[model samples]
Target: MRLNNKVIIVTGSCTGIGKAIALRCVAEGASVVVHGLEQDLGEAVINEIEKDKGVLQIEEITNEGAPERLVELAVKTFGKLDAVVNNAAMILSSNMETTDLAFLRKVLDVNTVAPFALIKAAFPYLAKEGGCVLNIGSVNAWSGEPNLFAYSVSKGALMTMTRNLGDTLFRESGVRVNQINPGWVLTETEIQRKRSQGLKDDWYKDISSVYAPAGRILWPSEIAAAAIYWLANESGPISGQVVDLEQYPLIGRNPPKN
Candidate 1:
């Protein structure tokens, strides 16, 4: 019950890390706003949370005034807000030659700008409760793989925003902001993505030991655990941090020899 009676908004909660965080928050006794872009997945999450006496709201965040509307939904349903997890992101591939201005703008709009919008909208509510903002960033923020060029750039922008807002909000209004840079999470999207690339069904066996030092990449719930830590009141007075949740050191990491 680490988050009893707390209220949090988790964007992209219809699936993957976002969904896991929403479920974990509900289990910990928090009312959650399970925000996402897909209806079926959102409904599934809402059904699961309902069983635990959890107040879960399903909303989409990809339109004009979406951030404000989402915050309004949380307050209207749960009576207040405590925190926000900016987890909605697009992971499209684009290398040097393929990355165009439009592609980069689209990536930034979702992966970077939307987060800033949501936090700004949720700020008043969070400030009233001395709440926090936890952004789900990536190891890609450390200048990711060439295939993830646009994604890496967007995440990098988000990392800087996290620090900037953490300092500004804490100083101006007592709200804490932090970012978690997860490395190689084995989400459903990743599973299918790997398969589409012609990897075998058990592609799970293919991760290099050096990349997956623990013998596996991260799971969504592991990231959720960290989210709870940052959201819970017990993690007091700390802000403006980017935590790296990777098996290997991110900076200057080289793949091990076969």
Candidate 2:
């Protein structure tokens, strides 16, 4: 196993991309700590991992000292922390002109501030173990999306944080930091939302024709594969880079050609 004996924490892992990353980590022989707000969903993920005989832990990380609590729990249960995937965030549809201050603050608090706090809190353990940090950013960070203003800004800040932390750790400590920017993913929620909005199979065709160069939306498992590679592989030399999950052939590329 690539991640044999490694200990990792994945936040917001109850569902979506985070869940996929946690499952992948467990498969790679790493003891995983699953953190999220939903107790039932978090437990379900833990159960899934446990069924495979993978050692796992669970925690509900909210605004109050969640990052510290998660790190402390990992150390207490597993004895050490090796990697952390800061994959927790919220996606809201609101532009600058229409978005309220409360909404903007909430989005930043969850998407940007929390990741930084977790990284800072986990720094000591990561430094000791020469571990790495993988942040789940978004393609919106680079593109100008109209309605997802707060989300885009938060992810943009996350990319900057990744670079800044990676440089600091590279120079001062052995810990590595990187970011993963996923494009439009077909999660369960998205699928259901599409259906609710009366979007049928042809909607997918429309989306593919419009956005994805590969003619398909990204799957959570694909993003998970990237996360696993960054965590399990000795690819520390490539730290501070943002891995875009969109099937575009170039960075900042969008609106796939027909």
Candidate 3:
């Protein structure tokens, strides 16, 4: 068990990539604090893992005191916190015209500010144990699609925060901070998002080569597998790194017109 006796707090774990990470952490012997806004879904995650290996926390990531509440839950339930997986985010589609100041602030609240708050709340515990922070970011942090203006901006800020803190926090307290920027991942929310956008039920089945070079998008489990490396001690002495997990070079890649 690579994470034997570790305690991890995985935000937004009720579904999708966060859920996959939580399940994987438990399998690797780390007790987890599974968190999300949906109560039933959070409970479903709890049911899948042994009762003793996982617990649930339901709260919007941007709510006042939410970070402290989550940190409190992890420490109260597991006695300490070994890692924090900043996986919760608000991914809204909007162009510059639609992204008003309020809209941008809301997106930043969940996608950028909340992660920093959680890290600050958990810093003391993480420092004590030489733990780490794994932020789930996106390739969109690099300019992003035209439709995702606010979302892309928030992630870009998050990327900078990761780099800034990954170095400062690691040097100050031996607590590593890193980020993984995943490409298109086929998660439940994406299924619903695409459907809501008027795509067909099987929209993901036939992605163009430009978007999915392997004939399909990435999976949550694949992202979770990669996450384990950063969370585990095996990623020794490494900090302030942003890894982009995508099928193709996100920059300057020309897709075949054929």
Top model number, lDDT: 3
Q: TM-scores across all candidates?
A: 0.95, 0.90, 0.99
Cα lDDT of model 1 by residue, 1-258, tens digit: 899999898998889999999999988889888877677878888889865334444454557888998899889888999999999999988898999999999999999999999998999999999999999999999888889999999999999999999999999999999999999998988888888889998888767787788888899999998889999988899999999998889887677787
Tell how far residue 90 is off in model 2, in angstroms.
Answer: 0.5
lDDT of 2 at 152: 94
Q: Per TM-score, what order, best first?
A: 3, 1, 2
Worst 10 residues of 2 by lDDT: 52-61
Cα lDDT, all candidates: 0.89, 0.83, 0.96
* Candidate scoring better on TM-score of 2 and 3: 3
Per-residue alpha-carbon lDDT of candidate 3 for residues 1-258, written as tens digits (9 for 90 to 100):
999999999999999999999999999999999999999999999999977999899989898999999999999998999999999998879998998999999999999999999999999999999999999999999989899899999999999999999999999999999999999999999999999999999999999987887999999999999999999999999999999999999888878787
- lDDT by residue (tens digit), candidate 2, 145-250: 7878998999999999999988888779878899989988987666775777688945665664456767889999999988887896668467888887876644
Candidate 3 runs further than 4 Å off: none
Segments in model 2 whose C-alpha atoms lie over 4 Å from true places: 51-62, 193-206, 249-258
